[model samples]
Target: MMDSGQNKNETTCAAAMNHRVTCNTFEPEGVPVQVRYAIFCGQSGIAEYEFYLSPTQHGCVDVQLDWLQSAYHQVLQWLNLELASGVFRRFLCSDPHNQAPELEAHAFSNPKHDDPPCAVSWVGQPPLPPAKVVLWAQHIDDPKGIKIKRDGATLMLDRGDLSHHWTTNATGVRKHSSFDQTQCIFEDYEQYLGKHDMTLADHVIRTWFFVRHVDVNYEGLIVSRRELFEKRGLTSKTHYIASTGIEGAPPMDRAKVAMDAYAVGGIDNKQVQYIEALDHLGPTHVYGVTFERATAVSYRDRKHIFISGTASIDPAGNIVHEGDVSKQLDRALENVDALLKQCGASLSDMTGYYAYVRDPSDQGLIRDRFKAILGDVPVAVVVAPVCRPGWLVEIEGRAIIAENNPQFPVF
Candidate 1:
C-alpha cells in the first residue's frame, strides 16, 4: 500500500520471502492533509494497522470524529481487513488550543463495543490535532491465552501471566515532586509485577517515559530508574530493560512523568534474547544510560523483535549528522535496519512504529521520506523533542517474522 504520489523506485527489499509478515507505509489521496498509514500482514492475514495523522489546528469535534472514522474505514476496506475485538493503543498530545477535549470527546463517543480497552495518553504539544493515534487488531484465534483488565485509564493485558501495562500520568503514592513521582511509579510497577510472580530485572523488556521537561528532569528519571533496577539485581554492567525518555506532558496537570512497560513472566533465558547491534551502535550504558538496543523473543510460531528508541548515534557513541534532520533520519533508519538484520529480519517485517520529531515543520517531509524508503510501513509521528538536544528524531518499533519458513532465518 504505497502512497499514490510516492516514487515506486524508492522501495527496496533487503530480503524477500513469501508467507512472512509484510509491512509497508502509505498515504491516501484526497485527504486534505498528509497522514502516514502503516499496514501489516501476518499468518492470519492483516493482523495490525496504524494511522499517523499530522497535527492540525483545532476543528469541530463532530467533524474530526467523522473524518477519523471515514479514513479508518477506508483503510480497512483498501487492505481487506476487519476490526476485531482486541487491544488498541492511542496517544494524543495536548496543546494550548484544547486538543485534549476534542480528542477525549471523540474517544468517548467511539466506545469499544467488543474491542479491548484503548489506552489513551495526553502528552506534550504536537503540531497537529488529535496528536497521534495507534490501533492494532489481532486476527488470530479467540482470547484464550490473553486476558485484559482496565483499572481507571490503565489497561493491563496478560498473556498467560506475562503482563503488559500502560498508564498515563500515573498518580504516585507521593506525587510531591518529579523524583517522588518517579519513585512512586517504580514502586507501583514492582508491586504489579509481583502479583504475576515476576521480578523487574529478569522479566521486564522495555519501558517508555514521557517527562514533562525531559532536558531538565531526565537525570532524575534515570536516577530513579537505576535505583529501582539495582534493587532487582540489574546494573549498567549487567542487563537493564530497554527504555525511551522524551519530552512530553501527561494528562494530569500536576504530574511530571508518564510510563508504560512490557514484561514477561515464567519465561526462561532461552525464550528471550537481548540484542545489541553489531558494530553499528554503542551500548546505551557507555554514556551512563542503561538499556539494550533491541530484544527478540522466540515463540513457537514467530519471533517478535522489539527495537528501542533509536537515534542517529554512531557506533562509537557520538551523535551523527549533528544538525541535519534529513541526514539524522537516514542514519536513524540505517541503525534500525542493521538491528533488524541482526535478528535475521528486515524493515518489511515491522508491525508498527512510533516516530518522534523535534521540529513540527519537519513532520510532512519526514513522513514522505519514510514512506518512500520503507514502503507503506505503519508509523505514528508526534512532535516531541528527543532526550538529547542534538538528536532530531527517534524511532521505536515492533516486528514479527513468521517461524518455520524456509526463507526466514532462525535466530
Candidate 2:
C-alpha cells in the first residue's frame, strides 16, 4: 500500500500546468482498451484522478458497457484507488417518426451508423490510506444508474435520477413532466445534502444540466431551476453558481435530464467569487437565465476555475457570429480567456472541456480546430445543440492552478 504521507510520486509531479501542480496523461498498462487518464496532484498532498474513459471500438451497447466496466476496474486496481463520480455519455439515436422507437435505438444501437456507444467522465481518489482525506459515496433508487464519490468537503456527484447531481435519471419510475421532474430532482439534491449536514445553496460550486432536446426541455428546466434557486436564497439580486444547461439524454425511460455537479462544504465565503468578463459577455440575467459565467474557488494551496457553458454573445445578450461555427468557436474561446484572466489563469489551465455543436457535420471542424489550438487537452465533442438556435456551438470546462497561500484548508 502507498504511504499515508504525500505519495513518493509527488517528487515526480511535473510543474507543467502551474507551480506546485503536476499534470500528465498515461494509458494504464493492464486495461485492454484505451483509457486517457489525467493526474493532477493537489498542493495539500492529495492524488486526484481526472479521467475520461472511452473504448476505441464504436460497437453495440452491451460491448461498450462491458468494456467501460473492465477499463474502469483495471485502472482502479492498477492505481489502488476508488471510483468517485462518473458521467456516462452515450450517442443518442432518434427515429424521425417515433419517440418510443428512438428510445429503443438509444438503448440498443442506431442501425445505420453505430457511433461510439458510451464513454465515462469519472474522478478517483487514493482512498485516504489512513490519512486526512475523507471519502464516501451515495446511491439513489437504482444503484447501477449512478456513481458518486466525495470527500467530506469536495464532492463530485454524477448520473443521478433525482446531492451534487441528484439527477432525475434514476427517477423514471416517477411520472412527471420535465418541469415537475426537474423540481423533484433539485429537491432531492437539497434534501440529501441536508441529511449530510450540507446545504445546496452554500456548498454547490458548479452544476451541469443535460437536457434531452434542449430546444424544448431547457425552458422548463430554467423555469424550475430559477424558482428553486429563489427559494434557496440564490437569486439574480444575490448570487448563483456556475452552470451549464446543454443537450444530453438521460439514461432511463421517460427521463429527460441528467445532472453532474461539484460542491465544497464548510468552505469560507472569502475563498469563492463569481467571474464575469463584463467587457466580453453579458450577465445571464440580461435574458431570463440565472448563472455565473465562471466561479473561482480557492483552497489553501490551489484555485479552481469553473467555466460555465459559454458561447458567442455580446455584452447586450445578443448572439454574435450567428450561423458560423468557426467564428462562434473563436468568440467563445476569447470569452473563456477573458474570464480566466480575472483569476490569473487561462485556457491552457483547463483539464477537461466539452464542446457541443448543434450541427453534426461541423464535428470535424470543431475537433480539428481544438486539436490544433489546445493540443492533447481532454475534450469531449458531442452532437448536442445549444439552448439557442442562433448559436452554433457552446463550450464549458474546468481549470485548476497552483497557488501559495495561508488559507483555511487544502483543496
Candidate 3:
C-alpha cells in the first residue's frame, strides 16, 4: 500500500558520534532498486541505522516485499524511529516470485528471513523469488534519554546506566540433545540477565548462533557454549563472547539451536576491549572456539567495533584460501582489517559490513568484490554457510570511530 511517497537519495554530513547524527541516503522515488542508508547521531539523542538494499529492479518478490514494507513503515513514520535491532539477508532456497503468497512486512523468506531476521517465514522449498536479495537492517533514535521496549523476542534499549539488548528467538527448551539444547540456551541467557541485575560474564556483547545442522549441530553448539562460558566467567583465562556460529534454518522445529543476542549494561571494565590482530588472526581458543575476533566498546564520543564470524584463517589457525573464493575474500578482508587495527578503527570507519556466502555461485564474485572496495560502505549479502568446510566466505561487522573521551558516558 505504498502508493507513492518517499524521496531523498542523499543527505550527507556524517561527522557523526559527536554531532549527534546526520548521515542518510535513500532513493525512494518510485523505488526501483538501489537504496542505501546511514545515520549515526550519537550522544544523548542516541541514533543508529544502516541499511544496504540492492536489488536493481528485477522486482516481484512482490515488488521486493513492498520495498521492505515501505522501508519499515517509512522509518516508523519518517524518522520517529523504533526498530531497535535487525538482520535480514536472503537467497537460500529462495524464490517467492509471487503468484499468491505475498504481503511481507520485514521481508524475505518466501516462507521468512533472519527472527535471526524473520519471525515467521522460513521455507524449505515452496516460496519463490531470489536471483538475489540483500538487506541488513537496524533503526533507532529513542531520545528523551532513551527507553524503548518489547520483551518476547526482545528488543530493548535504555540509557541511564546503559542497557541495550536485541535478544531474538533464543530457542530450545527441550527436544533432547544438541548438547542439551545448548545448555538450555545458556541457561536462558543467565536467566535473562537475572531480570536485569545483569551477568553473562558481565553482559554479552554479540552472538548469533542459528545452528540447525550447521554441519551437524556445530559440535553441540560449541560444547554448549564452552560449558556455558565456563560457568559464567568466560574462561581461557576469562573473556569470550562475540560470535556467529552460522548456517541457519531456524523455524524452530523443536529447535536444534537458534539465538541472537547483543547485550550491554553500564560499562567500564575499562570500557571493554578485546580486539587482536595477533599478527592477523588466531585465538578462538586456538581452535576449540570460544569467540572474540573483534570487540571494542569505549564511549565518550565513540568506538564500537564488534565483528565476529570472519573467515579465511591463518596465522596458524590454518585454512587460508584453500579452494580460493577470491583468495577467501582476500583473507576475510585481511582479517577484518587487522581487527580494525586493534581498536584505532579502520576499513574506513565501517558502519556496516556483512557478507556470508557459501556458494550461491559465489554471488557474482560477491558482487564484484563488494562493489570494488565498498563503494558506499554498506554491504549485505547472504546465503549463510561457513561453519567451516574450507570456509568459502564469511565476514561480520559494526564500527563507529570518533572518540573524544571525557571518561566514558555517551554511548
Candidate 4:
C-alpha cells in the first residue's frame, strides 16, 4: 500500500562462532535511512543488538541503539559501544535449574531526544540476581516532552508526551497466579493508554510476553488476552495485534509472567493492514487465542511488515510433521513465504530473524537448515521453549518493501 518513489535494500552475513548481522537501508524523499542488527550466541549466553541511522541537517547524524541479552558484560565489550544512558528491562527465567542463567535485559538509547533516561531508585530489594542495565537511543524530531514512570518492576516510556508508548517489566514476581498476574498486566496497560487518550484496540502493533513454564500455561495466557481483546471489541474479524508468547522467567523469583509492548498514536486506520497467509494457515482465534499472523503498516512511500511467531501449523490448526524438526522447520519457512508473497514480498526482503529452539542440541541443525533456505539472513537462535510442547521451534521476522518496485506485484 506504499506510494511510489521509494527504494529499499537489504543485506545479511554471519561472523565467526555463529554471530549474524543484517543491514536494511531505505531511501525516501532522497534521504538515506539505515538500520543494523546483530545477534551473538556464546556458551555463557546470547545477545541481540540494533542500531538506527538517519541523515540529518547540521552534519550531525541521528542514531538509536537497542540491545537485549540473556547475560550482559561480554556483549557490551564485543560491540564496543558505550552504555552510559538509556533504560533497562530485566527478567528472570528458569528457577529450578540454577545452571541456566535467568537474568535477561533490554536497553534503549536515543541521544537526540530529551535528557537521557536515569535509573529509578526503588526502596526494597529482593533476594534475587542483580538487574542488568543498558541504554536505548531513538530518532525523534523536536518533541514537547518525554516522561518516564516506574511502579515496582514496571517501566513506562512516554515519548513526545503522547506520540509513542512503551511498557515493560523491570523484574519478576510470583505473588499471584499466572492468570491473575497476566490480567493485572493488561489492566495496567489499558490504564496507561487511557491517560494518553488512546486505546489498546486501535494503536498497539506488537507485543512480547515472557512466561514461566510456557508449555503448560500458554493456553491460560491466551485466554486472558482474548478476554481483554473482546472487551475492547477487537475480534479476529476486526483484527488483533501481532504477538509472541514464549518460555522465559521474569527477573523476579516468583513472577510467572512479564510483558513488553509498542504502540503508535494518531495514525489512520487505512494505513494499517492485518494480513492472512493466502488460505494456507488458520486464524489464531479458532484455537481460542487472539493475534494476527502478520501486520503491515503502509507509509507514504514504503510498507513495513511484521510477521509473528510462526511454526509448522497447517490450515486446520494442527501441528504438522509432529516429530521431525527438519520437516517442521521447512513447513514453517514455507508458511512465512506464503505470508510474505501475500503482501507482495519475498524472503529476500527480510531484515532480521529470531528463531527459538526448544532443545539446545538442535541449534546447529536449525542454523544450517535456515541458512540453506534463506541464505545469510541475520538470525539469532536461542534455547527457549515454544508455546506447545510438541513444537520444536518458532520463527519471527520483519521485512520492508518499496511500492514502486516493478519486480514485485502489488497485492
Candidate 5:
C-alpha cells in the first residue's frame, strides 16, 4: 500500500503542456536534477534541469506537506541561483559552450509535448543549506547564473532559443508540424517559471515574439497573447514591455511556430547607467550595404547598441534593389557600415544578427553574398515573409562600443 500522503509518479498530472516530465532519485545526493523531455525543442537550448534543496527539506512536516513545501521552496532557491549567476554568463561558462543563438536554450526545454504537464520528485535531498535572495521568482529554477543586472537594472534571461521545423507547400499551408505552437511555448516557459520564486507579475519586462506566419495573422495573435497576459492581471503597458513581432521559418520541416523571448526586471542600478544589446547582428563585411541602429545604453567605458530590424531599406526606408538579392545584400552591408562608423565601432565589433530572406530557395545565393560581405561570423538565417508585403529582405543586430561618448544623443 502507498503511504497515505506520499506523491506517486502517477498521483497527479502536471499542468498541461508539461509532456513527459521525469524525476530522478539521487543516491549520494548533492543536488537533485529534474529532467523534462523536450523542454525547448530546437537548435540551442538548456533541455534538462538540476534542482537542489535546502538541508531543511526532510526535517519538518508529514509526507503531503513536505512534498508541497519542499518542492515550492527548492524551486525558489534555484531561481535565485540562476539570477545571481547572470543568464548569458551561464551559457558562456558551460563546457563546450555553444554561443549559437539556438543552442543556448538546449538544456532548458524538454519533453517536447505532453498533455497536462509532467512533473516528478527526487528521493534524496541536498545536505547544504539554501541561500536567500530578495525579490526573486519562485516558479523558475536557480536564477544565480541566469540574470543580467547592472546599475539597478535587472534582466532575466530565460531560455532564448526556439525553432520550428516547418515546410510550406505551393499553397503555403504548413504540411506537418512537429509541435503545436501554443503548447510548446507555454509548456517550456511555465516549467522554467515554476522553478523561480517570482509571481507572473514580476521579473518579465519585454517579449519578442517571432511567429512563422506573423505577417498573416499578426493582430489575432497579439489579441490572444494579450488575453493570456490579462488572466494573470498583467497588462502589456504595466509590464513596461515592448515587442517586435516578425515572420520567420522554423528549423525543421515540421514545426508550426518558433519563438525567442527576453524578460527584464528591477530598475537601473545607478543614475548614470549602461545597457548592453542582447540581440545578435551579423558581421558587417557580409553585405554590400550594412545597416545598424544608433540607440544604446551607455555605462562605464562601454556602449551597447540596441539596433532595430534592418533590410535593404535605405535612409528613406524605401526598399533598395528589389528582385536582385545580391545588390540588396550589398546595400544592406553599406547601411551597417554607416551605423558602425556613427557609433565609433566597426564590423569586427558585431556580436550577432538575425537575417530573414524572402525565399529559402535563394539561401545559396544569400550565403554567397554573406561570405563576400560580412565574412564568416556567428549568424542564424530564417526564411520568412517580411512585415511589409513589398519588402523582400530584412535584418537586425546588436553591437558594442568600448568607450563612453560625449557627442551622441541619448534615446
Candidate 6:
C-alpha cells in the first residue's frame, strides 16, 4: 500500500515491474527531490540537489545502506534519471538533517588524494558533461555550517559574521581590515590602497564609527574624525560617502574607530550624487548627508539601497523626535524611504532589514511598529547603543525592487 503523498503512479508501476522480475527486485521511484542553483560574479556556478523519501510514504524506511547493496542497480538508475532533467552541472544529494535511520549516497572525495574531506556513502557519481560534479560529506561537527565530500576534495565552510563575500572566482578577499593596530586611523594608506588599485577617493562607499566614551563631547570627536579623512585626501564634505559612528569598547578599552569601504574604478554609477531638499524646505535634515553616520550605497542595475547605520538626529546635531522611540524610529524610516525613492525604489520593496535598539526593553515596542510598517519582511533586531548617549535607536537596511520592473535588478 502506498502512502497518500507518495508517488502513487510510480510506486504502483514499480511494484508491477518488481513482481514480473523478482520479488527481491529493487525499485527507483520511491523518493522526493529538491533543487537550487546560482551563478556568482559572472563566473562560478553552484548547484545543489537533495533527495529524500516522500512526506507521506516510507521506502527503505528502516533499512540501512548495507541492506540495500543488493538493490544498487535500481538506485543508480534513479540517479541517472535525476541527472537527465538538466538542471545541474554538479550534483549533491543526501539526507539533509540526517532524518534517515542509517547510510546515505556515496561520499564524493578521498582524503588520500589531498582532496578536501568528503563523507562515506553508498552512492557516488563523477563530474558530468557541461560541468564537474563533486560529492561532499556533510560537516559532522556542524552539520548545518559545513559541507565536504568524503575525499576532502569538495568543501564549503560557513564563516558567520566574519565577513560578507561574493565569489572567490572574481575577487579574493579584495577588502579587509583588522583592529590589531595601536591606532584605529591608518596613516599613509596610499601605499596600501594603491596595491589593490583602490584609494580613499575611488569607492569608499560606506563607513562605520565605533569609538570609546562616545558621550564625552561627541560632536568634537566627529569633527576630528572628519579632519582625519580630509588629511588622507578623502574630503568628507563632498565625498558622498555613507557613514555610521557608534561608541563601543573595541579590542582595546580606548577610543578606536574603523571603516569598511567599497571601490570600483571606471564606474560612473559609483559616483556620488547628493539628494537635495525640496526648494522651499531650507535643507531637508530628514535626508541630508551627515558625518560619523553610515550612508546608503546603491548600484544602477539593482534598485536596492544599502543604508548603513541611521539614528534619530536632525540637522544642527540635535537629537529630534526623542523620548518617544517610536516617533524617532518613524523619522529614521522616513530618511531611509527618501534614499530608496531617490533610486526609484520604495519601502515596500525592502527584503532585509537590521534594527539595533539602545535598550532591550524597546524590542517589543519596535517589533510592533516594525511589523506594522514592514508587514512581514525579513528582519533581524539586536540591542546596541549608538555613539551618543542620548540616542535610543539606529536602523539600517537592504531592499530589492520587484522583478520585471525595467528599473532595477533582482537582488
TM-score of every prediction relative to native: 0.80, 0.74, 0.31, 0.66, 0.42, 0.49
Query: What's the lDDT for residue 104 in model 2?
Result: 38
What lDDT does candidate 4 reach at residue 15? 22
Each candidate's lDDT (Cα)? 0.64, 0.61, 0.65, 0.55, 0.36, 0.37
Rank order (by TM-score, best first) = 1, 2, 4, 6, 5, 3
Question: Which candidate should be chosen as best, given lDDT against the real structure?
Answer: 3
Off by over 4 Å in 4: 1-115, 118-162, 170-175, 404-411
Q: Which tens-of-lDDT digit does each residue in 16-35 have in candidate 5?
A: 12322222222222322211
lDDT of 3 by residue, 220-262 (tens): 8898788778777788787898888887666556777777788
Regions more than 4 Å wrong, model 2: 1-12, 15-34, 69-175
Report the Cα RMSD per candidate.
5.2, 10.0, 20.3, 12.1, 19.1, 16.3
Q: How displaced is residue 29 in candidate 3, in Å?
A: 11
lDDT of 6 at 9: 38
Candidate 1: minimum summed lDDT over ten consecutive residues — where? 8-17
Model 6, span 2-107: residue lDDT tens: 2223343353344333221101112334322111111111001111112221111224322323222222223334323222212101111122124222332432
Give the distance in Å from residue 19's predicted Cα in candidate 6 to where it truly belongs.
Answer: 51
- Poorly placed runs, candidate 1 (over 4 Å): 1-17, 24-62, 73-84, 94-97, 107-116, 125-147, 151-154, 158-173, 405-411
Total backbone collisions, model 4: 20
After superposing candidate 5 on the true structure, give the runs of residues whose Cα lies further than 4 Å from its correct spot: 1-207, 219-244, 249-259, 267-294, 404-411
TM-score of 5: 0.42
Better of 5 and 6 by TM-score: 6
Q: How far is candidate 4 from the true structure (C-alpha RMSD, Å)?
A: 12.1
Better of 3 and 4 by TM-score: 4
- Please state the error at residue 187 of candidate 3 in Å: 24
